[model samples]
Structures are given as structure tokens and as C-alpha cells.
Target: MRSAIHEFPDDLFTNNERKSGAVLLHITATLYMFLALAITCDEYFVTSLEKICEKLDLSEDVAGATFMAAGSSAPELFASVIGVFITHGDVGVGTIVGSAVFNILCIIGVCGIFAGQVVVLTWWAVFRDSSYYTLSVVALIAFIYDEKIVWWESLVLVIMYAGYILVMKFNSSMQRFFMGKSSKNVANGNAATSSEMEDVKPSKAYSRGSVVMVDEMMNASPSKFRFPEAGLRVMVTSHFGPKTRLRMASRLIITERQKLVQAANGVETQVIDGKVEIENGTVPEDKPTEAEENDTISPFHIPRGVGSKIKWLISWPLLLLLFFTVPNCAKPRWEKYFMLSFILSTVWIAVFSYLMVWMVTIIGYTLGIPDVIMGITFLAAGTSVPDCIASLIVARQGLGDMAVSNTIGSNVFDILVGLGVPWAMQTMCVNYGSEVMINSRGLVYSVVLLLGSVALTVLGIHINKWQLDFKLGVYVIVLYAVFLCFSIMIEYNVFTFVNLPMCMEE
Candidate 1:
């Protein structure tokens, strides 16, 4: 029951036997520092992934959901692995399960509230993803119902993840096939695609693309932590960096083609002298303005003051930050680099996670609190910071599907690959025996809560004509809060019921 960390004598780190403001300050400062680093790395991560998605010509929703989702959730994954290694109470399983629950309920909920309404471009995609995710969760629950993980069960989860990829591939191929249907269908498809594009027009910051966004709070809160500029950059840049000029150029190239399509649709087509023509009579098609051409403009925004410029001024200038992602300016447009940056960022997140855990432990020790409680509440939540950042960026970019998908994607990756692969290797590797214990009562309820949240989200989209709105967001957040309360109670022995009984009889 004892861990090395727990063996340290009281006042080992300090002479005083009582909690001190110094400890509080150390914890507070470290957490914020970690937050700043995490937020910055997250900016670069999303930037790189967006470029990768664009270059590969992949569906933002599917790509973001699976690849980017797994990438962003990397922090929680590593944290869980390490948590178990450190012999923290149920750290591995608790973090993954808790993080999954947090993603579905908190991250998705936040995205919904931000957009006011997060619409699904294809409810079919939603259903398709939901089905696989539900399958994975059910399988995991079945495996863990025995209060232990076995080699075969872990293998099944890993296999299930591979299947998820195959299914996604099939779905993407079908979408492409449909796009290549009749000419009429092709035009319709383009129209549908436009809905998925995160345009600058909808956001209040640009104010219909002409108004320069001005600061409302005179001095602009400039804390390095308040990286408003980072959010703004999401509009003007991609993973490759500042694409304003490139987008305009690309738009010009597509303009002539768009004109022909308009003529086919009879929007401005005319016949004179036995020849077809475009008449300026019916106003010419309006092209996106220079400001609007930037991709990062979304309906939601995080405010920043000019003070952040101090951060830009001292270390790396804003322009330098812009150039950092530019493919030509820095690295070549290789998939490996984007992938590498993502991998490194996850590692960075993992390193910061140790800091977070250590700080939380110190705080708990000072307060004479239990390790299990701290692991579940503080450490579990801390490790999910990347998911919080990545999903918000995706959502703000108007890829509502990707934003929501990432939540599902992250949870799926967390449960299956995160827990699965590690356990698979551990259990299958011979002579080393194991007795991995989980809180039976809490584990059962967590699975139920997870399944219910996923089902409710899918049903809400179905009921609202495949649209996600603030009401659903509110519901999920409330659901998560209730679940948290029940979990705390169960942990404290105030409530008790577990799913192992059914397995016991079997």
C-alpha cells in the first residue's frame, strides 16, 4: 500500500510541520508555467496538423478525429503509463478513464458553447464514428468487468482500433465516390463542402471582413498566458504558417472555374448572338476579400491584450512565430516533420505532466490528503490540458465535426491504444506476474457514465436534425458534474455498488 513518495517523513522538504504559503506559491507558479508552455506547444501542434491535413488532402473530420485526436490525447496516454509505473493508486486506469470522461463531457461541451451551435456536416459520419466508439467502450467494459486485464482482452482492444481505421477509410472512399457522381451532385457536394469551411465571415472579430479587430479593454491583458494572438493566428495561418496571400492566390485560381459553375447553374448565364455569355447584369460573383481569405476566422475568440506583444518582442517576434510554421521558411513540406513536431509536443506535454503530478502531490502531502484522491481529481484533470487546447482550436476553426470528432477520437485512443497496447505487452511478456487492481465500484459507474454520455451526444445530434447546440453542451457539463460528485462519494465510502458481482457468478 505504501509508495516511495508516501514514505517521505512529514516536513521532509521543509522544517515547518505545517502547510506554508511558499508551497502554495511554488505549486501555483509551476502550474501556470506549465499552462503557458502547454498552450504554446498546442498552438504549434494544431498549426502543424492543420497543414498536414491540408497537404494530404484528407477529410478534416476523420483525419482530425483519428490522427490528430490520438496525437493531442498523447499527454493523457503517457501520463497514464507513467502513473502506473510510479505505483500511484489506479493511476493508469483512472487517468485514462477520467480523461475520456472529461473529453466527452468537458471538451465537447466547451466547443458547443463556444460556437453557440456546432453543426455536423454529415450525420452519417457522426453515426459511423459513434458506432465504432461504442463498440470499443463496450469491449473494454467487458474486459475490465473481471477487475483485471488479460493479454487477450488487451489484444482485442488494439485490434478494434485497427478496425476503426479501416472503417474510417471505407467511409472516406465512399464520400469521394459520392462526390464523383452526377454533375448536379458534384455542384451540391461543393455547396456542402462550403459549410465545412471555417470562414472569416462569421466571426465578430473581423466584423464582416473589413473592420480591423480593436481592443475593447484599453490595455489588452498581456500575460504570456493570455495568448490571444495565438487564437487570431489560427485564422491567418495553417500548419505551414501565414496563408493569407496563398489563400488569395488559390482563390483567384479557382475563381474562373467557379464562374463556369455559376453559369451552368444559371446564376449569371446569358445567350446572345447564338453564344453563351456572362452578363454583369446580374451582379458578378463576389470573391473573398484579402482579410476574409485567411482561414482562421471563426465565430468564437479568446481576447488578448497588446501586452502579449511583450512576449512576442522579447523572445520570438510575432512575425518570427508566423515564419516558424511556414514550410519553405523552416522545414520542408514533409509529412515526417509535422508528425515529428506532434510527437515531440506530446513528449513535452508528458514531461510537464510530471511537474503537474509532483506539484499536486506536494500540495496533497502538505494538506494531509490521500494520493488516490489527488490522482483522480487533480492529476487526471491536469493531464487533459492538451485535449482542452486542441479541441478548442479545431472547434474555433469551424471544423465542428473535427472538434467533436477529436473528443471521440481522443477518448477512443486513450482507452484502446493507451491502455490496450501497454497492458497487452505487459501481460503477454511472460514470467512477471500481475495483479492490477481498480476501484470496482467506481470503475463500473465510470463505464456506465462514459457510455451514457456518448449515447446522449449522438441522440442529441439526431434529435436536433444533426446539429449540436448550447443546450446539449449544458446537459453534458451537468452530467459530468453529477458523475464527479458520485465518484467522489464512492471513493469516500459514502456510496458502494460494483459490476464485478455478475462476473463473479460467471
Candidate 2:
């Protein structure tokens, strides 16, 4: 099928007159897609997500599992839509499958290796998310096994996601039901431990035992902390996930860091009741502080260092483009128009996703690469960067459960909502009773491998005593490398000819 975005006949290789230019354009298109996704996710998508959470008074756990997951997984969803409707191939499925593996193996691996110390995970949280994720993957494998998806199958996937959402909605209840403990007791214990630890200095590094201690202290109860002036926290306590809490902590750190920068340039700092406060900005009676207002777009500002300057300079065009096109919900001016920002960001994500798929399909065709292979490799990694970065950040903060749950939970969203919605639209609505075809048999193998990766990762974490550290990181990373190798080889017919050779013009 000819791509709607392709200007060249057949592919870049088919036309000598503009072959080189076409190739370069496609390459640039792919890179631009990455930049576009990153900008949209960071600046607009997540900020809008926070706004929705605040507006709806949703819990952090529910919001993170649903809105945050959906927001971050938007690109993959759109890519799957493009793959099914436009490309009529396996690219979308391949991307989702590959991305699932990457999320499970590669991201966790990186977090483990670079998190600076052992970070103990909450077993129940990991188990809950991973179990649901496994079922989702299994459902995907079952649906795609025969290389066709019918209306009912798509419906099943969508319904499965609905069930997952419901589970997240009652996460605390489920935790209590399964763990045999009420959240109130846990919450109370957490409050006492947190207050005691408030005066203690954070240790430089955590050993395995210290990691367990930290995990116990942190997981003892839901945090009652609120950043009222920062405007990130809600009234919800037990619902806060590690990711949400970590972001709040990051906001405070950023404020302190900003104050330090200001002090270096001669801004005065005041010590009030043994706490350091900057005099440059004051928290308004009801309005968010300067730090809260710039929470999302703070990095867009030109900073004081050469490397940071260069990075900001490179990102300036994207920043400017997004700034004009989408409302910045984090800004005081557009604070109330978060829904508008969410809609606009989602639209941009769809556009970027379409361009990404279109370019990758053409490039693969030109270079004689199978769509599945391109999808599994390039598209997967490109789309998953946001999740990877988020997981790594939280992991470094010693929010191992948050990091692990995010990775696994996003996979669930990707498999169920990301792929499911598109399939449902095609079969149930777009063309009634129609079936979407899976172009490559290799994708089934890849998905099975994806399931295996999840099992192995969970097993590895369990074996490591639920601690994410350097050894487990290396293990999962090696698993990721091995997965990529096997997937590529399978697509290339090294093990079996499951995919047809890309048709090329002479």
C-alpha cells in the first residue's frame, strides 16, 4: 500500500531523480517525530494530565494508571491506528509488542544500573500490575495468533482495559483485600515514620538492607504530605503512587535548585525557623508559587551553562512551535483551560504518530526492511522514550514500585487501550464486522517473547528479593538485547521465513 505521506513513486529507491532527497526527508521526518513526541509528552500531555487530576479530584494511583498511562501511550495508540487503517500492515502491532518488551526489560535495566543504589520494590504493587499485564499480553497473543482480529476480539481487549481501569479505581480496596491489611493502619504508620525521618539527613547511598528499610518506611502507609502552594498535590492521600510523589519531590528540588542559582547571582535567602527560603518570589494567597507555575515549561527557558544552553537552543524551535499551538496548562494564564491543552496535545500526538508511521513504512520499503522489523526496532524505541525517562527518574528517587508499576502499567495500556481501541474502531465501527490482518507471523513470536520477557523480569526481581539494583539491571538489559536480536532474526528469516521480503522496484 502506498503511504499517504509519500511524495515519491513506489519508494525512495524507485525514483533516481530525488532518491537522495527523499531518503534524507524520510530520515528527518522520523527524527522530527521523536522530537515532536518528546515535546508534546513533556510540555503539554503530562501538564494537562495533572490539570485533569486536579479538576476531577482523582487519586494519584487512579490517575497514573489511567490518564497518565493513556497520555504517555498516545503515540503508540495513534501508530497502531495508522498501521491498521492506512498501512494495512503489522507495523503498529510490532511497535506495541516491541515497546512492551523495551518497557519491561530495557527501562528497568537502565533504572537498576543507574539508580545509584538498591531500590526495593513493593511486591504487591509489582505483582498486581504485572499479573494484569501478563493477562493483557496473553489476550493479545491469542487474538493475533491467527493473524486476524474480529469485532468481538477487539471488544474483548477494550473490555479488558475497562476492567483494568476499574481495578485501578479500587486499588486501595484491592490492596487491602489481597494484602489482608487496611489502608488506614498503613497510612497512620507511614505518617509517624515520615515525621520522624523528616529531621534525618538522607544517606549518600543505600545498601540492600538500607534499601529494604527505606522501602518499608516509605511503604508503611500512604503519605499525608501536600504541596498546597506548589499546586501539584490533591486532597487524596492513599491514592498517591510513587511516581506522583516523586514528581512532587522533584518540584521541591527544582525550586531549591532555582533558588541556589538565584543566590549565586546575588539573590538573598532567608532562614525562617531553620528552613531556607528565597526572597525573589512569594507565594500568593491562593495562587500557585513561581515554581508551580513553571513546573512544565521551566526547562524551556535558556539556562546558565554551555551544555544546557546548547540543548535549549536545539529545542527552541519545538518549544516555540508547541508554545503557540498548544495552551500551557501549567502557566497561570492557561491554568483553567487544561482540557483544551489536553485535546490539542492529543491531536498533535496523533499527527506526529501518523507522520512517524508513514515515514518508517516508506523508509523500510525503500531499504527492503520488513515493516515488522522497522516497527519492532525504530518505532518501538522512539515511542517508548517518555515512559523510559519517567521510570528512570522515579527509580532514581528510590520509588521502585512507582517506576516498576509505571513500566508494567503502561504496557497494559499499550496492549489493551493502545492497540485495542483502534482494532475496535476498525472492526466494530469503521467497517462493521471487518477483520484487521496481521501481516507477519513473526509478530506472534515477538509477542510471545514479550510475554516471556515479563515473566522473566518479574522472576528476576523476585529472585533478587524485589530489589532493583545493578545486577538485576544488567540481567534485564541483557534480556533486552537478546530479545531484540531474536526478534530481528525472526523477522529476517534466520529462524524461519515468517515475513515476506519487501517488494522493491527494479
Candidate 3:
């Protein structure tokens, strides 16, 4: 008895091709592993943030609004500041302001629309989180106006955050009672209840469907079936079930037999001794019914949309050019050009930064708006963009808790990491004899940031049952109003706090 295995032909091109394919596969696998690691790190960061927020006993809203939001946003903040420093301040200022505007007008606005639809801000969300955000903005402006952040000023910020936390802690006790009351009020006030629970259930149902689909797909194919078009044949079996299984098998055999007939046409046939076998089988005519005849027209011939057409027009040519030119471009001279392009691009980015600041200043002057007002607006919006992106992404992923947790985590990180890192860096750079002139602007910004955090904490404590109430929103708005008024007074040099002048002394 001979062995069933047959040796594959050995050829120079064949071995070379196999070796090349193996090398390509190895490289692809390594690249994929690295990419996976990077993504895992990002996810780990998010998870760590959540743990920190929970440990601090912060509510999801507070955690997200402050910590995770700020921490994840660190990259953008660092980038903006670097841009500012690189461009001798103007670009940095513009980058920060431009980013802020992008966050508020684009990111937040879009998120608000989605969030509003996702969790209809039951008057409470609007009052508590929304209102506090508004107030935080106002307080931030006040700090900017003072143009100096004394130790007391920093203490005030810490105090505000502490107050909010205390309020929330107290509110936690009354949460159940308020929740009951709110539920009862909602029941009485409206016929329709837009519960998040409804969304939760459907997702669970979809998960179950996915599991079933996987099982069915795996079992549908047979181990022995090796048709020329095996994938297409298997798909047909999956569609029609067991009743059409045999027919599909027969059709596959017929298709392969036809191809063999075409390849071995006009070959001589002979019957020898006791054996009788045809050298070439007759090609069966595949006569079509009306429906089958109509099906001869390829389904793939369907017209695509204008957008798809445009994309294809651009992509195909670009792909071909890339395919032809990339090897040449990878050479040393071309590589240097690529490096130069990157450097030039960074410089161009700085130019955009300067242009942005100049535009904002020009517009502010034309509108008779104060520079302090512009600065405050820029910082508040700039800082808050990361929060908006984090919140929206988390909310969309159905991890609202994580999102909220992340914000809180980021806030803590910003205070401990963000501010601390910068301060440490600055301190290290300063020599003992060289007066470490603390930039009053940075100090003021820090104070405002702390104050906003504190206010949120206090509001959280005051609210019953960890629930954000509308009253908090009112408080936020009022706090913001006071801050703005004080800011205006300070900007005009009409106010003084603890012997420090209100406005910046040119």
C-alpha cells in the first residue's frame, strides 16, 4: 500500500514566494501586537482613573467633570502650552483659546445633543452639573482678572471644592428619600418615563443574538467539503439549511467537473481490461429558468452613491501611485525630505497658533471686550474640551459611570499631576539666587481650577442622595455672576484684595 500523501513540487520561485509570505506574516503579527499594547494602555489609564474616583468617594458626575476629564486632557493641555512657549507666548495663547473654542462650539455642542437624547437631562442634571459648570466658568474669569494667585487665593479654591464635597457627602444620606420623591413626582407630572433601563435591556438582548449567530455560523460548515468555491458553497448551505444541503453539494461537484472538462478537452478516451473509465466527461449544459437567467446579471454591478464614486476616483489613483512610488520614497534622500516636511509642518502649526490669537484679540478689541474676559473664556473652554470628549465617548460606550469617574480622576490628576508636574519642572529650572518669580497668571489659573473643583465638591455634598439638583445649577450661575462682576472690577483697577492690585501692572 502506497502512502496517501503526495510531495508538492519544489521550484525556486515557489520556495522564495513562500518564504516572503512567511516574513510578511511575521512582521504584520508583530505590528498588530504593539498596536494592541498601546490600546490596552489607554484602557488601563481609564480604569485606573475610575478606581481613584471611587476611593475618593466622589460621585460619577463629579469624578468625570473634574478628574478623568482633566487627566486624559493632559496631552492636549501640554501640547497647547508647548506651542505657546515655542512661539514666544502668542501661539501658545492662541492654541489654548482655539482648542477651547473647538471644545465648546464643536465637541461639547455635539455631545450635548447626543447626551440630551441619551439621557434627557431630567431638570436635575441641568440644575446640578450644568449650572456648576457655568459658575466654574465665572469664578475662573475672576481669577484671571486678579492676575495674581496668592496662597490665600489657592486656599479659597481648595475651600470651594471641599465645600462641594461636604455637601455631596451629606446629600448621600438623603438620596434615597429624594429619589423616591423624584420618582413619585415624575410619575405624577408626566405620562412618559424615559428610563435608561430601556436602553440597557436591548443591548443585553443584542449580546444574546450575537452568541447565537456565532454558534450557528460555526456549525453550518462540514469538515470534508472541499469545493472549488468552498466559501460561496458554504454560504449557500447556511442560507437554505439542511433541506438544500445535498443539492448544494451536487451543484459544487458539477461546477468543478465542468472546469475539469474544459481543461482536458479533446483528450482520447480508452477502456482497458476490466476497467471502464471516460478520460473526459461531457460538460453538462446549465440551462437557466427565467429567474436564474435574470440572476445572470451580476448583483455587484449595482450603482454606487455619488460620495462613493468620488472616494473611489481619488483612492484608486492614489493607491496606484503609492504602490509604485513608496519603495523609491523610502530611500535616504527622500527620508530626509520627510523629516524636513515634519519640521516645517510643526512651524506651520505655530503660525496658525499666532494667527488664531491675533484674530481673537482683534475681534475682542473691535467688540470692546476686555483681554481678561477673553483670557478667562479661552482657558475655561480650552480646559473643558478634554472633559467634553471624555464624557461623550464614555457615554456613547454605555460606560457613563466610567466617564464620570474618569472626569473626577482627571481633576485629581490635574491637581496632583498636571499642576504638580509643571510646578516641579519650573522649580527645578529656577536657581536659588535667581528670584523664582511665580507667574501670577499661572497661580491665578490654578486657584480658579481648585475653586471650581471645590464648588463642584460642595454642591455634590449638599445634594441629597448623590443626585444633582436644579438648586445647584442656580448656585453655580450665581457664583459665576459674582466672579464675573469681581473680574470686571479688578480688570478696571477698581478693586484690591489683600494689598495686591486687582489688575495686571503692565
Candidate 4:
């Protein structure tokens, strides 16, 4: 008899049915974990967090810096907690390091590639976030240098985070001070640039050159592309932040959904190049009023196509479970009890994180891969999905600063809060005068690579004239690939042996 289990090779089985079943279980668990995280974050966690911010009357900058960063980073944080108390390994730290690299390089690379148009970033926001993030990374490296964390070192990380929050609180004044002196010079430079652009006309309508010219115009003055929607022409002008534009776009999308009956009746609505265009010259007078928009509850969308339907069917069980367990705070009835929603959503996040880490750990063990490698690659990427989605949405809306700031700022949160809270709990609460051990020395090298990735990314953006576009996208993506390769090699001792072989069953 031969056994099919990779980790338990000595066991004999009559057939491979058991192995097939095990593989199926792994796949099922992985998919369910991602589905649970996605639903919890998008529907419950984010909505409840927003309401909490409103209730607390936190400023937009503060909310974005603190709670919003936490909301997007909840999974990584929970994963770190599980790593500390449950697994007692470096998985949590590795995940944070990998996720930081992913957020800075991969997310920015994605934004630059898929944003559909070149978006200019404000230098002050980038510099502010990046400088603080670099310091956080340096602090993390210093704390973990000996592969052990004492109570005070963890406390330092927490205190540094508090300082970051204060910096965000005073962000406006700082930004003004930084830009005040150069404001006039920038204005004059912009005038010269626009005049220079005016002299360069497109030679052909359908040529690549012509498209670039049109993109430049759109980047310079988006108001020219404004179209009437819901009896109002909402223009995403140069002065408007991408966040504001995103809100307006969401309202337009909702209003358009209300007018779907008009499209069914006689008005032809076609989705052309990702834009909903009306064929009729006249606008529909019957639009959803402000009250109606305010009262709209989230609609359950049954996606079209056989493949999509199958996915939806598979995800239905998890969706139903969450719907019953967690209160939907976005609804008007449960809206007041957002705190409850936040707490419940958080509990679910922990549960899901535990399951995800457990599955990944088992998978790594079965494959003879180190826990740090698993954490750095699969676990890191999986847990960072929410942050990736949020950044991409803002990037597409032409809010490059918000998108870039979000990626960098979330790195700070992941490093300081995600890793700090757990270490603090273990050292201070779990047992006084105790230290948490980092089993792998490779992680230090990975963190160093993480710091370099940030510098390269910021330098790349600067060299590209602060434009998020195809070229910059390619550059940063290459850097991400190199980072992953080096980290994996470092863990495997390809360059230097830093990890022990996994224990195998004989």
C-alpha cells in the first residue's frame, strides 16, 4: 500500500481518496477564509467604523489615519495576535513585513497601472507619510534585532504610533507650512506648463500620441469630461480630492441604479469603455430624491453568468452565516448601534484570522516550507486584500495622494499597532519580564529589504515627476518581484542559512 499524504509519507492507505479529501479541505478552507474576510471588512467593519468616527466627531484626517487604517488592517493585526499567543512564531511579524512591502510597492504599482489615467500626487503628503513610515520600519528593525522583544521595546512602538496620530491631527497646518512658500512658484510653473501644452496639438484622433494628449488634458482639467447625471453635472475638477469624487461617483452610481426602469422602458443605456452612456439626447426627469438616496439599503446583487453564479452559490453559506451573526449597521434600523456592529465584526475578524493562519501553517508544514515564508507570501497577500481594494478605488478616482498616503500610512499601522499590541500583551500581561522570541534571523534581512523598497518607490515616483502611470507602475512592480525573491531566498538559506528544517513525520 502507498500513502498519498505528502507530510505523512510513511503511512499506507488502500487508495488515494483520503489525500483527495485533504486537498479539497485545504482549498475549501482557504476560499471560505477569504470570503469571510471580504464580507466582514466591506459590509460590516468599514460601515461600523465610519459610524463610530461620526459618533466620536473625529476629524477626517484623524479618522483616516487611525480608525480607517485599523479597519483596513484588521486582518493583519488579528493574524499577528494569533501568531503571538497561539502559534508562538514569527508568522505575525513576517506577515506585517511582507504586507508593508506589498502595500508600498505592489499596491502603488497596481494603482499606477490600472488607474486608466495618469494622476499627479502631492509631494507633501507623500513625503510626510513616507518619512514617518521609514522611521517606523527602522524602529521595528532595531526592536527585533536580537530576535527578542522586551516589554519596553513594545511600549516604544505603541508610543510612536500615538505620535503618528498627533502628526495626522496637525497635518493641515504642517502641509500649509510646507507648501506656503512654494505656492506662488508652483502656480507660475503650472501656468507655463499649460501654455506649453496648448502649443502641442494632436496629429491624429486615434493615434497613441493623440490619446496621450487627451489624457494630459483630462489630467489637467477633468471638468471638460463632465457629464450630466441625475439632473446635475458632477464634475471631478482638478481642485477636488479623489475621495470627494469617489463619493460623488457612488451617488451617481446609486442614482443611476434608481433610473434603471427608464433604461428598460425606452432610453438606451450602454456601457461603453467602462462608462454608462445614454444614447438619448434628453435627460430623465424622474430621479431619486435626496431622501430616497439616504434611505437606500444595500441591495443583494446576484451576478450574471454561470461561473459567477457558481461562485455566488459557493459563497452563499458563509454570507448567510455572517448575515445572521453580525448586525448590518448600514441599515437605518441598526445604524444607531454601530458600536455593537464594530465589536461583532472584530470578533469575526479574529475568528477568520485564526482559521486562515491555521490553514496556512498546516499547508506550509505539509509542503516543508518555513512558517515565515508562508506568512511573507500567501498570508501577507491574502490579508492585505481589503487595503489593496481601497487603494485601487481611490487611485481610479484620480486621488493619487489619498491612495498613496493610504498605502504608506497603513504600513505604519501594521508595523506599530499590529505587532506592538500582541507583543505588549505577551510581555506585560501574559507574564511580566518575559520576552517574545523571533525564531528566524531571515526576517531582519526581509525588513531591511522592506526599507529599501520604500526608498526605491519614493525615488521612482519623484523621478517620474510624481505621476502614477504605466512606466512607474512597471518599475515598482519589478521592485516588488525582486523583494519577494530575495525574501524567499533569505528564508531558504539560499544566500545564508537562517531557518531550521521543518519536523517531518516518519
Model 3 Cα lDDT, one tens digit per residue, 15-50: 244344543443343233222222221222333344
Estimate TM-scores for all models. Answer: 0.63, 0.83, 0.35, 0.78
lDDT of each: 0.52, 0.72, 0.34, 0.70
Q: Please give, for residues 90-122, the per-residue lDDT of candidate 2 as tens digits.
A: 888888888888888989999999877777776
State the lDDT of candidate 1 residue by residue for 220-323, as single tens digits: 22221111222222222212111121222223323333334444466552312221222211112232321222222211222133664444443343224333
Steric collisions counted per model: 5, 1, 39, 0
Output the lDDT of residue 147, model 1: 74
Q: Name the TM-score of candidate 4.
A: 0.78
When sorted by lDDT, best at the front, the candidate numbers are: 2, 4, 1, 3
Candidate 4 residue-wise lDDT at 92: 85
Which wins on lDDT, candidate 2 or candidate 3? 2
Pairs that clash in candidate 2: 186-221
**Model 4: worst 10 consecutive residues (lDDT sum):** 184-193
Models ranked on TM-score: 2, 4, 1, 3
Q: Give the TM-score of candidate 2.
A: 0.83
362 Cα displacement, candidate 3 (Å): 5.6
Q: Which RMSD values do the candidates have, in order?
A: 12.3, 6.0, 24.2, 8.2
Give the C-alpha miss distance for residue 264 in model 1, angstroms.
38
